[model samples]
Target: MSDQKPSPLSIGDFATWEPVLRLLWAGSEVHHAGRPARVAGRIGRRSWSLNLRTRLPSPGRAAQVEDIREEVDAVKRVRGALADAGVDDVSFTAEIQPSGEAVLRLLGPSPAVEPGIGTPYPGALILVDGSLPEPWRRLPDPVAGAVPAPSADLKLLERRLREGLPDAVGATEEEITAAEARLGITLPAELKVLYRVTRARWEDYNDDHEAAGRESAAVGCELFDLDALYIADASSRHCRWEFAAMEAVDTPPDAAVQGLVGSPGWIAFGDTGGGDRLAVDLTPGPRGHIGQVIMLSHEESIGAALVADSLTDLVLGRPSTRSSSARGQRPPATAWVTTASLKNVQAAAHPGLEALSIGVWDSAPLSLAPFTGLPRLRTLTAYPGTLADPLEITELPGLEFLQLGPQEWRVLLDARAVPRSLSAAAIVVHGNQDPLPVVALANEILALWDRPRIVQTVLEGAVGPGPGAQPGADRRSGGTPQ
Candidate 1:
């Protein structure tokens, strides 16, 4: 309705997906002589999503199975189709008739969707353009009175670097200016001094491995060159919506670094050998110094740990006064509303809440009135039949991600009440259901966003009845067919 059209989803030729259907017909067990055998899978740019019965290799090489070499090759062939179609992922369902005919249906290339997590079904559907998770949208709080720490001495940092790497090449003023222009941020005084002492350029070392190692040791981390410096913003760190929606940002009063996904002022300067980043924090915490040093660990999703009070302390091998014990007082941002969890929506309703997952409920259905206008609430996932009324979803103004059962989505679709504020959405399927109808439902949701529809292709070919297992008979059992 907004006239916002998503990019085209190009459907590749039939030959592009044919080999996979052939492999599916050959690989799966045929359960009946009279009925068609069905097999379904999802394919992404890099990997294939195969079911447990498909029998691929396990981590321990323990699962019993047939040779999966051809299955892997077949998936690779379909990946080529994804590449050709210019989409990152797609899903398919194939039917092999007892009469040796086969039909393969390619489910998507929907620009609005992301690949589901370990499921044959699709993931979050991006309902709005350029929408990001709440945590990603949060900017660091400004500490107006913050000043450089006592240890932040640019002269001492340059002097220490000169003492250690006397033969190292430093960055020219023009090169530093060019880097600042490219990144659109001015380098801190201490950082500028460190770069001036040694640019950390490989060409400067004339391919000398020892020289690079010496520079790294002198800098107390693997220092990046002036040109390599970048702002560690939220856009720089990519996380899937399913996981990102569950995170919350909280900066403690005593923290030296702001608790954020990333910041425009957090200039990454080096790495701590084990894939962690060392950044100069211009957007410091409440009691923190303006140019404190923070380490962005690779393992965590949000926030940085104070590595040192300043870059001068880093080079001098001094520890930060801020301790990790001071940071765990924030309220829970994600809440689970279910029989086993919080018990009810009213119990989980809090101003700090960001995501709420409504699981299987044994009692009467619940209402959405408890969460009507909660400003920070962005994600909501309710199990099938748990909601008293699906139309209550319209009252949630800030919801960016919504996951409901197919029928709930249908209720919203028919009433034309699907929230326009949603950035992404999903249909939660509990039991075995036909994927065709589900794909159709997904298309309706995509249509609302003006996203390309999942192209359905019907291909017919001879696929002989798969080897010997009959309907109601387990081939491994020492019993007669029922």
Candidate 2:
């Protein structure tokens, strides 16, 4: 793909996808009229599948653009299609004709599922509307008689700002009130005081970079304008289901800051200039003050680091002395069964557990009895043949997302034991397994919810034979293969 953004391709037109389809056909080891060559892959707005194998870069050397330029260009066309369609990602399958004409089909998910993370397939099923992961649903513990830190000196902060920015424009009382109403939460006293001293708007700097730099230096961070102030809640931080489902919230009793994805009390008012957010924490941990300062790191998915005891201390260049670290290992919210990770299912069984993944194991197949009636368990994914009995999944009552092999799914479907509680599902495809059967199984799951089935749009177009187009290797590749 070009570094610069290109115009979106015609999503509904076959010509836009011919190049991509041709590339897939070229790379296929098996392509003939008697056998319909199968190609399956997913493409997202920001990511896509590059199934073609290219030479690995030499040691101590980065890959050159030419290494996978053809693959990147091929996937970029699909990305353009996603943009034109206004969907996050799309999973598709195609079959090549002997004359080089191809039959292409795109997968359309129902409204019941969120867009799958990094895949073209359907994401987590929404059995119930407005359903959220356990971590996102957590609220901070309320503290009685919580007081602001002694370092919170409103007068001193305002005085310092005024002295440093004599010609700066401050926000009016009405502007501050409007911001509070927009956020649906009262601004902390120190934050309000800081805003009153200087609104931190670009207009205040008159588009002068030097003036803006001076204000950032004076305030200790790139402060947001009054109108730009927003509540740092879970909704503000977008996390995909695959990762979000694995996370758990834990706040130690003695800690000074809550361990959460985002909190209602975290009022984002400034930037750390490195993509992280600076917020005034109103919902402080047990030992924390009412209005302490915290920095939400961009690189992390959950929790914030203590920047200072108070906003006043932040401006005054004082490091936070309060200890926010939790002492012991947190309850395992996500578990993996494999030789490299957790060795057994018993070790992972806990009331707090949410997502369980059974990877390639050399030991005997395991049972789901250990997770029976576990209140929080929502996601379960097992490698093919790792489960002793596929019917044992019925014991897990709260499963929302389940990924299992086609054989296991057959057991559940034949026995009429498919869980009614599932919000989303996936088939663990192995080797050169056919996708038609997998799609058939996926339709069965969607049928349970009365959701729309995945529709296949077949398009006929001639693109000639591919480079590696030959017989004998019927390979299937795409998505994060389970």
The C-alpha stretches of model 1 lying farther than 4 A from their native spots are: 1-13, 31-34, 52-67, 324-330, 338-343, 360-366, 373-375, 464-482
**Deviation in Å, model 2, residue 296 alpha carbon:** 2.1
Candidate 2 lDDT, 101-178, residue by residue in tens: 566666664565565444444555455556676778788889877789999998998888888888888889999999
**Model 1: lDDT to the true structure:** 0.79
TM-scores, all candidates, are 0.84, 0.85
The C-alpha local distance difference test score for the whole of candidate 2 amounts to 0.77
Write the residue-wise lDDT of candidate 1 on 174-282 in tens digits.
9999999999998889998998888998999999999889888888999999878999999988887767877778777776677899999999999999999999989
Cα deviation in Å at residue 354, candidate 2? 3.8
Q: TM-score for candidate 1, please give it.
A: 0.84
Question: How does each model score on lDDT?
Answer: 0.79, 0.77
